[model samples]
Target chain A: MTKQNTKKLSLAPIPYFWDRDYTHQFYQQVAQSPIDIVYLGEVVCSKRRALSLQDWMTIGHDLQAAGKQVVLSTLSLVEAASELSVMTKICQQGDFMVEANDMSAVQLRTKFESNAFIAGSSLNIYNQRSLDKLKSLGLSRWVLPHEHNQQALHAFDLGNVELELPAWGRLSLAYSARCFTARTHNRSKDQCGFVCDQYPDGLAMKTQEQKDFLVINGIQTQSGTIQNHLEAINDDAVDILRITPQQNNCFEVIALFDQVRKQQLSVTDGQKQLTECTVHPISNGYWHQKAGKDWVA
Target chain B: MELVCPAGNLPSLKVAVKAGADAVYMGLQNATNARHFAGLNFTEKQMTQGIEFAQSRGCKVFLAVNTYPYCHDLPTWQQAVDTAAELKVDALILADMGVMDYACEKHPDLNIHLSVQGSATSAAAVNFFAEQFNIKRAVIPRVLSIKQVAHLVNNSLVPIEVFGFGSLCVMVEGRCLLSSYATGLGPNNHGACSPAEFVEWKNTDSHLETRLNGILIDQVAKDESVGYPVICKGRYQVNDQIGYAIEEPTSLNTLSILAELKAIGVAAVKVEGRQRSPAYVRQVTEVMRAAIDDCLTRPDKYVVKDSWNQTLGDLSEGQQTTLGAYYRNWQ
Candidate 1:
């Protein structure tokens, strides 16, 4: 079922808050890479204040010039009036395509005559009926829910609705406006003091086994293990390979995915390189219907 | 304060009303509402009739159109609002903005209470919905601590409803996809958890076990209850030591904290089971109503006791009750 020629790999926007200089540097390098599309903007708790809209626009333009199509991303956890207002403004922007991570954005996406926004995985899109409905609402493409298998994916009834699968990146598990990281630090949301920016990928939570089980990025706690589909990327069913940007060595991760996309690296070789380079282990159970942290080879 | 009870069907609605529930919330028997179950909810024809039945007994019937509408299905959502407005229920519990906007613009007279599905936890979020959608009340998310709810109510303009009794989620409300992470159907989209059709109970060993969509979910022991396949409340191994990796099987019990809830100025205490039996509705309603009454009568001696901890025996997957976000360190 592996498609000989896969849809090109894309770099999803950073889901955390990094320093402005670091943010500029990440995209500056992304501008020179082989990634197809780059998502820009914060998708976690609203307290990540390092990047402004103008800063996001600048990076979007820079990534576009670097030959990558940049889509502005709305925050997954929009908790306040200001966040909602910000979401409305972000969806209305004409220059860049928008990724509606939250349902509020979906409501605003249909406000205009256009229905071409990217639906984020957080939208809980699972069934063909749901997919068909979203397609009718003008969804250009949908990020498949993490727990889907080939049976579920192929079973999507509508032929027109496009599917984008997460080939790389730690699963964006859950979003909350309440920052667990801030609470862990004994601080309120307003007084969080930009603490989450310290950990680029996310703050890893280990079991008593001291095994890295989960990672907390502000209010959004993701799996500690990244999801790798180097093997599945060969399958024709994959319309988009989303490589989420982690805090460290993400450029190398993107390059490894590029090698797999180009067929230069075998799945075994890719797994070897991935194991060598990635500090954290990789899991694809989400695609296999086992466990979010299970590796199914 | 009002005690909002769940009515999965006509019998349950009547049971809740008879058991002293101030209000009963229900939905049109479809995926249009959050609790879209097989034997649950009312038909549109029955919904109209049920609203009248609740009214006859000095009880209010609120319609829940709380599921998020996808891109193309905005009209159906609009029509849902149109239908609810036409039905003239006391209120329409809403989660999505377009539906809220439709209710605000078309059914201007409708009292719009934000559904917990909306997950408005912050004063700012509550105020935002109040300002933009003109929402009259907010059902706060199951993430805010009691102090947090107090802070939120103090800062916001709208009346706030808190979960005084019901399903205590390990993860924050309106956020976690662990259920979807396991099964595929979840609250944000289909408004279900570990959908029954996807669940399978098999015999892996001596006793029969439960699986959600073919994944080995729970192993039942002799004399132990075989609960529903809820991702957050199942046992799993993190590093070889098997335990409840996601959440334990206990439902939230705030019966002991009802006085604290009343002191916090919460507008209503909501129970969390619409797909439950009429007996379940009556039982929970009687307990919560007693707790609220004790809060009003005794005042000083109104400490809600923890006796009715009723093992709820795997209620998270079916109809559940949680004290969501009212207490600290519930996990």
Candidate 2:
């Protein structure tokens, strides 16, 4: 494998519903971190109005001024026309790079900007041909889908676009029209009382055997375990490591990944530090092409 | 609106055609299609015969080459497309953008319909696919409400088709990774979710347990009726409650809202089971065809007949039918 010091660290957009103050405070800590890129915006639910576009832009400016590249991420599921309009506005901002999570976002970004955009992992890019097709539409970098295994990556001709992989945090598993968080509280989606804020890390779902299975965050369902690939940070395929924001010490998590990627700390020590910060167990089975919830290591 | 039915094999295709289906959709006996189950789908000779039989009876046959292919296996999907085009099927239902690009450039004359696995929920997404590949129609995912379906139909550049009667997928198609999280196989990568090989059934003294790859999916008393062990439909615990957290084991039956769907200008109604038997196809196709014809003929006097309901219920998963996301309350 080719070797270089090109590995960078990226902060994935917040997938949970954090209150305004908590959101601000989280970014305040992120600004002082050694992360290379900061992706800001609400990518999960449209009802999550804790941070508006202007609010995210203000934070983006702050992160940019702090020597971090800011990328605004669009919603993964674009259902309403209003959401499409918001996406259009974000794509046309021209101030920051936009991560196209859905195809509508990609179309809007391609229509507005000539420069390549970052294709988010939600785009379902499974093959080289799909990658080549996206490249024609001006894809600058592509995030591998969380389900993609090491063998799948080896076979894919990533071409010239940079590859980003999720290194830590809950793996987003499924999305539906029904708000699971609302359903959990026996409320309709239209009348949902923004109860997702009650569980900043998301409501845990367990199997019948009481095994922690999944987490419900509004309409998005995520893995119950944190997916950490810190040991694979030096893998040549990954150009960037994405650390998703969580409720706890995400700054420390980012620092741990940074140290491990820079080879300042051994992977074993980094994994131990990561385990201490996570609320649940850590899984790396996805990297080994096994069930995503399994810990192959 | 036209009625689109699924036919897993030649017998199913013949059954659907005999039952007055407007079109019968099937796939090759390979992993290129989404319903890549054992002892199902059609061979090349059977596909040619099925096409001839359907065309002779003024019915169309669509080939579903809908599964996403990775780099190493893309040639298999491309070969399926070439075979479908050479067999002179009515249309190719595709989901992958790469495969769509291939079909668009390789066989310009072949018709293309966006598969439900494409997950185009909004007008902008549909228009993007239409503009890029010139898809003739796009199937809407089962996640939209009836009002949303109407809005999409009014705004879509191409005609839209929605699921009418079949197994309901609670999660949006093309986006779910729950199966892969459990069994290491999923719709996008493996074309099947909660594959049969991973399923295990055990009977204890008091209850019957269903597991998927050693993960407990559901457990029911011995006297209770059992449903298919699909991962999403299984009972699970969320908060203090334990039940069908994701979705219940019910089939999506939109028969009661046929008039509303027809009024919204929905182009076609798609059935979901390609892994089902020929008997299931015949019964569902006949009932849906009768219902659609009756609704179209007398919209003012249309009523969902009890007989039709019984027929569908007898074949439905868990013996229950719901409007699914067509009604907001079901959401």
Candidate 3:
């Protein structure tokens, strides 16, 4: 059911590898936006060295100074020992609340006895008992997996845990050890030359019919069509609406969402404005229990 | 190291046991298991008979109720756990956290093996499951190189099991949603990927087209053979070129690395594909069994025979094989 007013807006970390100056400018815009929480980190390939952990911490501090709650997100796939070590440092940094993207991150947080952390969508918590199990291990909130539907959310008996939903940006569909961005260039992942920086958003993939199919950013694959859930911002089941960072017009998208959530704009008008913000097609099919590429309306 | 094999039906189970599989893993005829195919998997009666047949042959039986259950479907998964415990299978392979919690509480004595669908790629992730659910063994995803695999084996709190042969999952198992993005059903939630009902193959004047839920996945010349329409294996266009942008159709064959896996202290080597025929299971089990036995017998003199490699390659998808991510070069 649609509640008249939504609670909060969160900015998901930049899933791409952008230039340092470009990333700083993006955050400068985010600092002045109406985002309530800001997640900052290199959640995708750890090889993308455009930003270091200290760099993210600086951005976090700046966003915090701007009166936005900040979260440090760990990597979604931890395959290398070096990657695991990085995750351990994030879990133990003890500066900001951590978002555990993988079970390895969750284990380290529980072992270090961090008071409470956010469960990233990739944690694979599909049921209430699973959430409860993590709750016992110090979980305060969780971002629902993008594939989950409204019916699945209703089934979860979330006692006091807050729920966050992805409301905008390209959906991260899958991750692999093999980097597609490198493979597209016929280069191995180790010798990738950090070419992912060329596509600040992500490299688009199309079907044989030239239909938009997917986006490749190093090891992560995302939906070619951006997901716009502006209509669902008023969902009472959601405590926060997540807006992933894009290469352009992100704040305008955030402002439109902010207006919609505050009941300052109609859903129809908000969606119409959202279409002008990105060249990609928009989808809300996952929220309607259909294929993720479809738009219900 | 142990040689674990897949069995989709009672006949396949018997074939695997007779072919020298140390243990045979089978799934129930429901969405509780990953291979939720139309005509694949075991009914309750078939499961009881299969378990009895395997046990009588001195081969252990593992019940795989490995799919994640939605909260509304908790009772169905809980019932599966109860049935597995009552039947007294040697161990249960599970992926869902809630199902694992239920099995741990209801049948504390039952052994649990973390399924690859659990997506535990590191020591910390496996240890977390071991501490929380008391899982005796964990299967790592196929995304790790041999060096990384050795590192995890060295650090994991419990014994680790790695896939020996299978249709490789290019993406991490449990975290992937590409199939659902196209067809609205996936391995994690629906126990299937590129489900058969959504697949359609069309023959044209010049080429054969493969589609999943009406989206073109791959089109091959009339002379070229087309395998299943898994999204990762399909060709797509990126930039100016059209090719296998994700992955080519190939099966993972670790026959060359059998000795290395044993040397790394891996507990078992699992052969994937529960949807294969009994003939495929028989040949794969025989080859894997002999390979493991040879490796254990004389680690210094172990060499993969050309005939064994030829036999496995013939049975692979697309009649091709790859080292997959086990070798760093593949990554």
lDDT top scorer: 3
Q: Is candidate 1 or candidate 3 better by TM-score?
A: 3
Clashes of each: 14, 0, 0
By DockQ thresholds, what CAPRI class is model 3? high
Which of 2 and 3 is ahead in DockQ?
Answer: 3
**Where in model 1 is the C-alpha error above 4 Å?**
A1-10, A13-167, A176-242, A246-249, A256-297, B71-79, B297-301, B305-324
Lowest lDDT block of 10, candidate 2 chain A: A1-10
* Interface RMSD (Å), every candidate: 6.9, 1.1, 0.7
**Candidate 3 lDDT, tens digit per residue, A97-163?**
9999999998999978565889998888888899899999999999989888988898888889999
Model 3: how far residue A197 lies from native, Å: 0.9
Docking class of 1: incorrect
TM-score attained by model 3: 0.99
Per-residue lDDT of candidate 1, residues B65-128 (tens digit): 8887654556777787888888888888988766776678787888999888876656655665
DockQ by candidate, in order: 0.15, 0.74, 0.87
Over A156-232, each residue of candidate 1 has an lDDT whose tens digit, in order, gives: 65466556778878888776535656655656556778887777767765543355666667777787788887777
True contacts kept of each: 0.12, 0.66, 0.84
Where's the lowest-lDDT run of ten residues in candidate 1 chain B?
B311-320
Candidate 2 lDDT, tens digit per residue, A1-297? 225356899999999999999889889988889899999898989988988999999999999999999999999988777888899899889889889988888778778645579999889787888888889889989988888888888887776888899988899888888888888888877888898889898998999899988899999999988998887677888889998988777888988887776678888998888888776988988889899989986
